[model samples]
Target chain A: MSDVATRLDVLKTYKLYVGGKFPRSESGRVYEVTDAKGEWLANAPLGTRKDTRDAVLAARAAVKGWAGTTAYNRGQVLYRVAEMLQGRREQFAAEVAVSEGIGPKKAAALVDAAIDRWVWYAGWTDKVAQIAGGANPVAGPYFNLSTPEPTGVVGIVAPQAGYGHSLLGLVSVIAPAIATGNTVVVAAAADAPLPALSLGEVLATSDVPGGVVNIISGRTADIAPTLASHQDVNALDLTGAIASDGPGAAPALEAAAADTLKRVVRPELDPFAQDWTNAPGTDRLLSFLETKTVWHPMGI
Target chain B: MSTVAANAPGVAGSGLQDVAASEASLRRFLHGLPGVDQVGLEARAATLGTRSIKTTAKAYAIDLAISMIDLTTLEGADTVGKVRALCAKGRTPDPTDPTTPRVAAICVYPDMVATAKDALRGTDIQVASVATAFPAGRAALPVKLADTADAVAAGADEIDMVIDRGAFLSGRYLDVFNEIVAVKEACKRPDGTSAHLKVIFETGELQTYDNVRRVSWLAMLAGADFIKTSTGKVAVNATPPVTLLMLEAVRDFRAQTGVQVGVKPAGGIKTTKDAMKYLVMVNETLGDDWLTPHWFRFGASSLLNDLLMQRQKLTTGRYSGPDYVTVD
Candidate 1:
């Protein structure tokens, strides 16, 4: 080996992504993040409740601009995210391998699947309106039509215990809510947050507007509850919430979400039994949407 | 008039411009004032800004700051409807809660003074008009005087005039002093009761702490009823140090001349916490005499909403959002 004093590698400092800018936790707190084997990897920002409040603010500010965009343009922007992820597939695969304790080949497969998940959701952006909304049958002589609108800002806790699908599970939850024109503030998997944090870089470089999707990592218990009860947040995604603060966390979050009448996506029946490699559906997209029905006078 | 400015011939009084008998004497008097310790002044302002104001104090400060706000809309695009809406918002900041204190005044361009006054009728909330070639004092003496007269005739309770920074910077202290004297005289209405005169320094253009100090005293000596920091139109509006310095100047001015002047730090002060810092600075520097709405004000539009949001957060258990407040 040629000796040049063994060129040192520059380790990445993981930070919270909010409002399109990377900021360390406002609390200046970091927690020791270990690999699957419990080997030290990095210190992820220990995002606090204030971080949740800030992310919610950013997500709320982005709602009008993101939702007002044409659905076709939104699809293109989401598809561009998939393209950016494709180019960085190897970097994410390496991260996934260490994070999930999997072989490179398996990690690569998961990364590919996550990229495809984005593509799948990207295709649904434009079609959700036609499929989820339609003309309704009524007794009155009126042309009544229904259209789906985003439920404003949605807060997500990515699955932390589902076969350690750290990258896949995180991507699966995030892509759908945003594809439907809803801005999101997501809590990455607490145990394995490197891949999720790196996704923020990809999103920033992609065409996604700042504040549209804020990625915050720490204990889900520290962040999710605030999002649940926040008056500004319109919906909650608890798909990965069971392990956030132990047993009954999801139900507690749902109870808090009810204070503001927020629409909640409850965790799976058995969170540990869930898998992200399964075929995706439009349920995640529809769960965070409100149906806007309009009645027009009809005369021929 | 039962006001401190009555001693200085600013509102409903005779000429007090006699203090500066000549240009040389005015310059000697201004330069004769103590030099500012730039580092010390800034350090003290910074230290005071860091003081933790919490809980009940925060709630009180929020309401006090609300009462001291001159809710302003000085854009050229301002319409009658917009001014009326602003006045209504000023009258009742939070329609959801009737207990919220109304703002001090509704500040608009001179042309919109009539509209704001009309809308704010039946309420004690004064209508303050920005005159004397506001934001930029680049007009002739007659034009500036006529602008002040027009706003005064249209029922403006206070006139916010700007100092000719060009003349002040060129060592023509007498020109700037004379201009302020003329504007103060123009503030008089036919009923012998005159509107209060608040002089704006545009301190960001003044270049140093010493200039801010110099102008603060200059404005006070020129019969200014109030001394303001900026027009909220500059790139650098109000900072803690400049405001602190102005507060100190007004303090010393009252000590010497027995004529107290108000202070308004407009622009860039957006949060309840920032407003509290200014309040704390005032409390420490000027004491209790200058804490009332008649003595201090915040010339801001967005700061009102933030203060309301904080006030609501205090009243309600949960945090508030902009959607819960008015658009302004």
Candidate 2:
């Protein structure tokens, strides 16, 4: 064997995903990521409130076209994400094993389950309106129909810590938000942000439009307040906050979100301990949606 | 016509005098004015826009911006009722609070000039009109001249005239210069008082920053009292860098000729934050001299309500919604 190794692996530089492009945080700050053994993994961009603001701008700009897309077309695009994630299964599995201190078989299973979760939500995209909306029986000579529409931009606090959950939790929160036609600004898990950042790359190559999914990797405490209080953000998901900042953080964020009357989704259990492989309920799908009832006179 | 001689004291021999005399001189004058570094200008404007004006200064800027607005209605569907409503809004922007200072002027189409003047009668608020085949400037010289004459005859305190973009782009510099001079003469009333002439470059069509700077000097040299950025009708109207270039031109013109010309950046400036950024640029670039409504104005329609909402927030310490403000 040679005394000196000739080759070295080129590690990826994780960046914030905004407006469909991967850019370094505007503050030029980064945090160290490590494996379960405490070895240095990579430096992830420490996003700031400005990054959250830029993400909100991008999300708001994307609302009109993304919401106007046919449900069938949205489903096809989401399925395309699954197809791309499946191609990168090995890379994600390896990362998950190292980050979560799991064996290869468990990592593989986790990656498979995450991909299948995407496919499940992909199928739900077309059927959500049918399940959540219906005709409202009203008195008098009128026909009324209640249809669900996107509530504009939604801010997501993805569950951090632990490899399998970090990746799957992000997919769980984000797919439902966007599948229902709302654009999302996701604050990915802080310690285990590599998988989420890599997913941003997958999203870019997939058919998803820019600005539809803006992912920021940073401390949940630092980014969540800005996302919650932002006047333009229409909704928020507090999954990652409950995981990273303890249960007390969610209500503070929820109270701050009340300033703008944001539609908030609070977690029922510890986000880090949830079994992401199980079938997700329809509550996530109904979180970011608003129902609009249309009335028409029979004589018309 | 004699106003050109009166205004051309220090401006002469600086190439502003003989711009229309020869094509070579006009080319030399325009080309001789410093070349614009696009990247540097945009960076400087973006950096200035980051300055945070809070609390007391925010209130001051909001009010200053409100006072500088030229409440305008130039749509094809504008009617006498619309003009009257705009006039009332201009007179008292916030009816609940009489402390709100009235706007500087009310701008409208030339045919509505008389209605605007009648509605704004017995007040210091000026009735400005867009004239000289405004927004396009594609008419014959006689028709353009008559357009200005008609607005002036209808008691328009100010005439906002569009430069012939076709002539300016094709290097007919003298035609553009003389057209401005003719409009300046047409702004003069029979009673020996001339309405202040504002020359609009329609800078969106005049693509290059170099063109914007050159035309600024051209309009000022030809006896224009104010040099406006756009007609508020283009895809890109009144960007910060374009307005910054005009502010620089006015500063330089004042330094050379000892004549101060006002700068108005019209269109796309819709929010209080946007107006505050422009005011910050003006404050830093030209100092407090241009901060007054006499030297700076925003030709906007919807900007008033936003300014009012922000002002209410400043006074009440709570955010106000759109429903509280009246719809024009």
Candidate 3:
């Protein structure tokens, strides 16, 4: 701990999330989870179905304020999260090390990499929409456009147990989704909830208002199907779901999501070393989209 | 009224001095018309021609000397077969060995120039080269002119040189004119079959239609044989609007001075539809004479396929052929 941090009085705050406010879980239960060094960090209150409903409501509330902001301003706000992450980087490194079971140095590097990725997407928030989406030259005088916009609330099954690599996979999905204006409900990586929960703390401090991202840590297979089936959830990012040519694994989720017509990104079949420096687009924005056309009278 | 001068610069010992004088005249002309938008001169800048024809038009004439040198796009055994089929069209039917229309000279890189010179030995077609770090002429002036001279010596019938856009954009217009003149002075033929020179304007990077017009006139006034559009390297090269404006300038220049300078639009041209559009534009705007190869040439690799496809459609009742026409 830094001498200043140790000298200053630190505060602890916890509550169930709803409508940009954190409240007690409606179930009135708490679960004790330990960090990597086996030290009890914070008692994360066990959320119920009612708690899930509240988080969705919170996500719905923040949507107007978030998506309504100018693209440049939104880009600036998202970029600020990168700045905040850099500022408290040591803390994230320590938490990631404990939660992810990696060395602190490696965790610190990953945190930096993840933060840098956010900065890249933040700059792109306004521009990618310009490059990939533009005014389509219609046959008539009617002006038509193809644009990338938020896909509303997303349900994500975060990577499962024993895969710390999947945490980054989860971050990749959430950052690109929300960066383009979608709010998310991420099921924390199973057996690796500490880092995910710590990430939630970072978000609470980072100007990412309540419910922009709601993290639920539990059995992914058990919790995911409910999130996927939720009629209110507009899309599903399934990087966490196991790959399957098999009958049940993806097909079940596929069928469940099909009821609601959720957007799905299958796991990479041949993953290369992540060239995070290469610009990410074409793949990200197309994942969630609704082509809306508006018509209005040109003359009286 | 003569396009070719009896005492052109590179004929004797007045190479550098004549180039400097030519550049001075061009600068004076550009400075004379402050409101002019585009200016270019078309001379066989590489060939030693005596007479310098000056025409003041609204648009610049940038004559580009481009020849297709790279054929690696035709790769693999299948590609080899396509090329051979194209070669089969090399002859016109002759009961007495009637010769076919030879390709407009086979342009190749310097190393392959000798091969082209050998292959096109007795043909009326002239071999051309894109010299001076073409498409982007940011190389040293000496190196660029030397590259032109070497290519010409190695059997290039014409030399196409690109002006440095950085120099042009940096407002060093005089230097660009001088560079073209210097390269033109370098393309001397000992046997007196001097090579032709085409100066490329790379009009796309010039931004404004007004600027394209001004550079067109400048190149033409300074003695451009043909003014061409684009090195085919930039994001915006040879759009219809830009070409339309330049073609108007070419027409006006020819009307004023009685000097017929060719116009070449060199990039992003694919498909017979595109070629026909250019042909239509030339015929409609610049008159029927400009439609011939003397005034027009499509600098493209894929244009042949499209032209062949259109030809087949015209001849055959239905479009019956393989996906790609046998290149011949």
Give the best candidate by lDDT: 1
The better candidate by DockQ, 1 or 3, is 1
lDDT of 2 by residue, A186-260 (tens): 998777888889999999999899999999988788788878876678899987776335423888889888877
If you assessed candidate 2 against the hidden native complex, which CAPRI class would it receive?
incorrect
Candidate 3: where is the Cα deviation over 4 Å? Answer: A1-19, A23-25, A30-43, A161-167, A243-249, A269-282, A294-300, B1-328
lDDT of 1 at B264: 97
User: What tens digits encode model 1's per-residue C-alpha lDDT throughout B305-326?
Assistant: 9999888878875667887898
Better of 2 and 3 by DockQ: 2
Error of 2 at B223 (Å): 1.4
Candidate no. 2 TM-score: 0.83
Quantify all predictions' global Cα lDDT against the true fold.
Answer: 0.89, 0.87, 0.60
Q: Per-residue lDDT of B189-256 in model 3, one digit per residue for the tens? A: 88866677777789888876667776776566555666778777678766665666668778877765
Higher-ranked by lDDT: 1 or 2: 1
Give the candidate number with the greatest TM-score. Answer: 1
Q: Each prediction's TM-score against the native?
A: 0.89, 0.83, 0.41
DockQ rank order: 1, 2, 3
Angstrom error at residue A215, model 3: 2.1
Q: How does model 1 fare in lDDT?
A: 0.89
* Superposition error at A49 for model 3 (Å): 3.2
